[model samples]
Target: MKRLCKKRELISMDLTPLIDVVFLLLIFFIVASEFKKNETILNLSLPNSASKENIVEKKAIVIELSEKKLAYKTSEIDFVQLEQKLSLLQKDSQLTVKIDKEVKYKRVVKLLDILNKLQLSNLLLITKSQ
Candidate 1:
């Protein structure tokens, strides 16, 4: 007698579409994420230095000084306001100072004076890498 039924083949699912969808979602998330841009409010021509050290502190307070204005953590502030805000910080608190390359010497001196008076010496001066 002849066999009534033929052998059946196994069915398999294609994974190419699943992988493509996952990669597409990954690319979408990568493109959608926003990176933090430090001191984006001011157009600063930062002075360049040859040193390659990146000593950014996570908890440091940022002070940005441009030719026409000064900003503390992105908010425009005057010298008195700066002094007041800085005075509230601990002596050991880290401070990141970003001064424009075109800023006047007197302004830098003035900022140094305030820092000196406060005795907040944990300072990091941010400069562009050469």
Candidate 2:
């Protein structure tokens, strides 16, 4: 008498569901991510310049000068406070001055003077292309 042999089924994993889950997660993150814009909340009429080069630096210190008040980022700050803040920043940190066209010339000069005194080398002036 011969003994009958039993056939064993091969085990396999279906990866279609895994792939679908991964793709769904990717889509969710893409939709949830925020995109930064060049537009600022502060109303500013930027000066026009012939230069077209746009340089963006990491951890840039932005100082906005409007006709009425000076702002460090979004909060309004005084000149002395600005100086104190600048003094705390690293020497290599990039500084971007965004001055409104209607702002007084003396205000710009004062800010420049402070920057000059600090000896911050990475300085930039934000202007619109004409």
Candidate 3:
């Protein structure tokens, strides 16, 4: 009598290798991205939260304001000078304003108004957490 042959499984796929490749790519992006380029001059005491996403990949020219003075990047610049530089730079009007916690609110508002007057469309305000 002839013995019956066992049927083999037709469909089979390995996910382990694919998962490993994805994991490696994730790690590569994390490592390749730079978190900070220069010593962030903005004394923005950023408000803390339960969770905060790391600001990476998106590099923006930093502008800082303090009760003591106003500045672009690290260099101290007057409002007129700032405007001139802004025009010269001719970069995106969108800018980030890093303000000290102790600074007056009116000052911040005034800054926003000036940015608007300059037609700067985007403004990011910085604040500190209690």
Candidate 4:
């Protein structure tokens, strides 16, 4: 009697389902994610200063002043409208002002006067750090 040997086959995994699930998750996140808008639209050069200390505040109202216009959260507004909007904010709410380097000093003084009237003492001036 002669003895016979049996041949063995290699096992492999099917990764098609795994790849499909990964692609579906990527698509879902891409559709549900929110992109941040560019906050600075005005072509104004910011002044630089050598300051190491920085303060970060949450939920502060941002006001941007350019040579041509004033902006609040990307919307161009006038002084009257800005005053009305600021009037609605809480007396202690923090305010951040981003004024262009070339903007006149009087405009800044005017804004400061408005803030003084509203008594918004928590103010932050945004400037570039050198």
lDDT of each: 0.91, 0.85, 0.68, 0.86
**What residue pairs are clashing in model 3?**
47-129
Best by TM-score: 4
- Which ranges of candidate 4 are over 4 A from the true structure? 1-15, 31-34
What lDDT tens digits, residue by residue, belong to model 4 across residues 7-89?
88888999999999999999999999988877766666889988775675857788898877998867889999999899999
lDDT of 4: 0.86
Candidate 2 has its poorest 10 consecutive residues by lDDT at 34-43
Model 2, runs deviating above 4 Å:
1-27, 30-32, 37-39
RMSD of 4: 2.7
Best by lDDT: 1
For each candidate, give its TM-score against the true structure.
0.71, 0.70, 0.53, 0.80
- The per-prediction tally of clashing pairs is 0, 0, 1, 0
Candidate 1 versus the native: TM-score?
0.71
Q: By TM-score, highest first, what's the ranking?
A: 4, 1, 2, 3
Expressed as tens digits, the lDDT of each residue in 1-130 for candidate 1 is 9979977989999999999999999999999998877654677889999987876877778899999899998889999999999999999999999999999999999999999999999999999988
Clashes of 4: 0
| Residue pair clashes in candidate 4 | none
- lDDT score, candidate 3, position 46: 53
